[model samples]
Target: MFARASEDGFIHDMVLYYGKTTLEAHDVPLKPEQEGLGATSQIVSVLASTMSFPTTTAIFADSFFTSLELVRYLQDHNCRYTGTARDNRIGKPQLGTIKEMEKKAVPRGTCYYVTSDDGILAVRWKDNKTVILLSTDMGEGPMSTVLKYCSESKKREPVGCPAVTRSYKANLGGIDKSHQVLPMKSNRRYLRLFAYVIDVSLTNAWVVYKRDCKALGVKCQPLKDFKL
Candidate 1:
């Protein structure tokens, strides 16, 4: 299943992947470009269509869901997006290759970036390893520092980090947080799918309940207590 969640762990939408044949049978909406980019990009487009507030929503996806075409599409739709990109998916930009960026002579925080004609910024930054990030909403400037443990130094040292990278790391854990509360074991072995669905439903309900409680200034029950 493909899911979109808020920064606080509220699942806003989900799409079950059953292959292109099933998607076509269901008449899932996909633009010409989205179709050409393949299934993962199509999923991102479908999820973007379901956004309650597209103009105000900022999407953060991992390399699995990010591509230059996807970033451009989201920008055209007026939704901001920031995500790490696979080197192959970032299009042909005049940036240093991963090997060059990872050389021992290069500084730890070295960054190379390029802007497309349509305003997509592709950045390659070196930390412990090279990370390629794409964004329609951020740039290389306004850099920040993050603490990383260095093996040679045997202590944590501050490394410069791009705003885009920092933001992605901070906000990409919403779905992970939601997954933490899901049941790991179930009694219905033969109906595991059904059990999994129920677990997700209950988790979403608890999130909504907590949201409402906070809005009304009331105490909210813990997930375990709420389930009981």
Candidate 2:
């Protein structure tokens, strides 16, 4: 399953299908449960892969999807996973009860095979501290293995935020010759589609600006700053 975001950063539609074979692709419309963009994305990616074959499956997630619901979702569907859990809140996973993970004498970067539903894990890549990586068919123990796998990825270079405002005379963020805002929505569908379109247009503009900056030595700025 997969989803396309609307102009307002909402997932207006979704597609769900199964991989008859590896690397298969299918599409479906958005469901009510996917009102939130984040859930829509999670459901789409997971459903797309597991709905077809029922075997030892592996899924990966960043910090956003490390929660009870997501964990239960994967378990209910019969799939293995390796996702980064937050410590206290966003990236914070409460590091208690996992005392067992700390007793070992493994090196910081050494893999600690994590094997429980939730426990402490030392992310050797970050400050070494026990964290959670709930999984079933863990290749190594629990904590270490999860950390090693999660930490193996190279550190991403920091990127600046995008400029969202536009400088075009026509405030037409979407299109047309008029410098005015979007049309007032007469229906919910209109509102949803309009918001989605505006957001996508904004994002597309940012990407273009960033690309141009990289290629033409121009500084990145908002559309408002851009003169026609």
Best by lDDT: 1
lDDT of each: 0.84, 0.40
Counting clashing residue pairs in each candidate, in order, gives: 0, 41
Off by over 4 Å in 2: 1-26, 29-51, 88-131, 139-228
Q: Tell me how far the alpha carbon of residue 45 in candidate 1 is from the true structure, in angstroms, after superposition.
A: 0.6
Candidate 1: the clashing residue pairs are none
| Collision count of model 2 | 41
lDDT of 2 by residue, 1-228 (tens): 244332223233334334433223334344444333355345634353434453544544445555545555455556554455554422333333345445555334333332334432223122255534433333322222222233445654322111110111112122221113233444686575666466545555555556679899877775567553
Query: Where in model 1 is the C-alpha error above 4 Å?
Result: 25-28, 186-190
lDDT per residue (tens digit) for residues 34-123 in model 1: 677657877888888888899998999999999988888889899999999899998899999999999999989888898888888899
